[model samples]
Target: MRRSRCLLPAVGLLLITTACQGGSSEPPRATTPGPATGTARMAADSALRWSPAVVWSGDLNSCRQGEAAATRDCLTKAMQAGGASADAVTAAGQLSSAGELAYVTAWHEQDGIGVATVAYPFRANTNEGTRLIDAGGKRIDVDTVQLDDTLRADPGVQALLNAHPQATPFAPARAAGGTPLEGGGVRLVYRTPLRECHACADVGQLQIGYDFDATRHFVGQHVVPTPAP
Candidate 1:
């Protein structure tokens, strides 16, 4: 298993203090039902909505820090430090939060092929930004609006929360990340501490799959047993 270090704030905020692991090279596998998958479908018709504006606002604030020009300068330095060519910043723009942290994303041409990178300020409160290059490093088409945001707002997610009120406390914070599907769409994941097992480190997660068009087509939930400290 791949191990990673993460920092969880009091509000259950998920933050990656170090470099993030690269994505899998293989294509996404088919969805298989797990023991917790049943309860994930408890509510199929509730209206739960996520606000892209809200997400964008948070993302902008993260990098901009109230000064647009300074944020641009930070991004320029970040891309340069990441070995990006001069033209990278030309097509780059601020993307929604990557892994829930503020980042500046830009596209670059490497050996005639297009690639994208997400850069963030270093952890030590420095002016430089560390870059997370995509695993494939393939040309990335920027989507200012992400499908995962829609998945978070899906009624199914709300329905799941209604079925299990305990999960409500972790609302918003429970939302982790979304992975793009092979066919088209994205898989939204949510992880929250188990209510009954307060003393245990076990975590319950709900994974919801949505089509490229933003339709929730699959729902699965499972409890991950705590790992050894």
Candidate 2:
């Protein structure tokens, strides 16, 4: 084996050894930070708001069975903190699968539909700024209406809310002759899960009306029994 001698410099009794016969070992190759540098990756995923997971903790109480505005503020603030968007709390939506954790996840109500959160303005407000989106590319925002109907605890009526839960509120209500107005009547058409599948498919719709009085308070549910064939 052939050997090369490295030239050494000494200071006091210490020696600095430059062991290889090369001109600076390749200049350290200018490094460009990759996209996954821990901090950068974390910053990038902020839109999802996944954790401290604790940033996602707090009052996830049901908005059902309460004064509309108070219910809206309490639940929405908690849910938003818990990484839930307006849409995530709407229309059969749950914080965890099958309502697995927090307020809605830990409980159920009598004569209530377990569903995604849907909000409608109990009254009018000027919250027209766009701050969020839905599963679709279409843009929507969190407003009083979207906050109030947030039934974690959600369910909304058309033409009835100061604003509607649907992206297209002005579109005609799917229910025939049901009022979508505040203190007005509401009709909901829904299908019960035929089996115990949280993330499956089912078919069928049974509808009933929600009656409200002139004071805009929930009165009672009105059901027209299905006729046998």
Candidate 3:
């Protein structure tokens, strides 16, 4: 069984509460929860200033309407290119399936920009991987992943895990409210099995997520040269 990590105290304020619109709410949208010491705590404190929110279309039923159709088309092409089409389409369908496909939007607090990450039912799969998509359903990027060496022991990831006994690397929260938050929002954290070292068999475990700030401008995805390990 995958060993569990301690969780940090759920801090900050919950501005809104509704059934988790996406698939899982285990990982908050900002940073991971775990133990932290001196400088690590300071770093996390600074990062929390950015308010983050996950956005998706409010009306899924009208997906074929407006920019929804184009978004679907772009995802279809992405699937044809060898990315996970099945999962991609399913995610798209979730918006319309629920009778609402509100154009999902996310905020990048640091840059003060809002970028649409996914519609509702945001799905993340090892087989599917990450891809670049446009508001109009254009194919812009493929098989993207982010890795960080400092995250292995970062306080943000550590403190949360330490506080909650149920927290684990690959496990979901046993309780609904036992999750971590930064400042005013939560961070969506996850792990991907990729090599982080040349000689070591370590996978590129990630703890990154999306944040949406309406004022921030969307810069194109930063192309990380490393491939999924």
lDDT of each: 0.32, 0.28, 0.31
lDDT for model 3: 0.31
lDDT of 1: 0.32
Error at 97, model 3, angstroms: 17
The per-prediction CA RMSD against the true structure, in angstroms, equals: 20.7, 29.1, 22.5
Question: lDDT per residue, candidate 2, 83-128, as tens digits?
Answer: 7544444311222223222222321111222112223322143211
Predicted model with the maximum lDDT:
1
Look at candidate 1 and tell me the lDDT of residue 159. 43
The total of clashing pairs for model 3 equals 51
In order of appearance, the predictions have TM-scores of 0.26, 0.22, 0.22
lDDT ranking from best to worst?
1, 3, 2
Between candidates 1 and 3, name the one with more favorable TM-score: 1
What local lDDT does model 1 show for residue 100? 26
Instruction: State how far residue 83 of model 2 sits from its true place (Å).
Output: 10
lDDT (Cα, tens digit) per residue for candidate 1, span 1-229: 5432211222222211111115947433326654444444323112111111111111223344555433555554555566544334332333323422333343343222223344434333222221212223222222121223333354443444454444422222233455665555344433333232334342333322211213333322222222223
lDDT of 3 by residue, 33-90 (tens): 4553435544543332212222322333333455655355543443345334333334
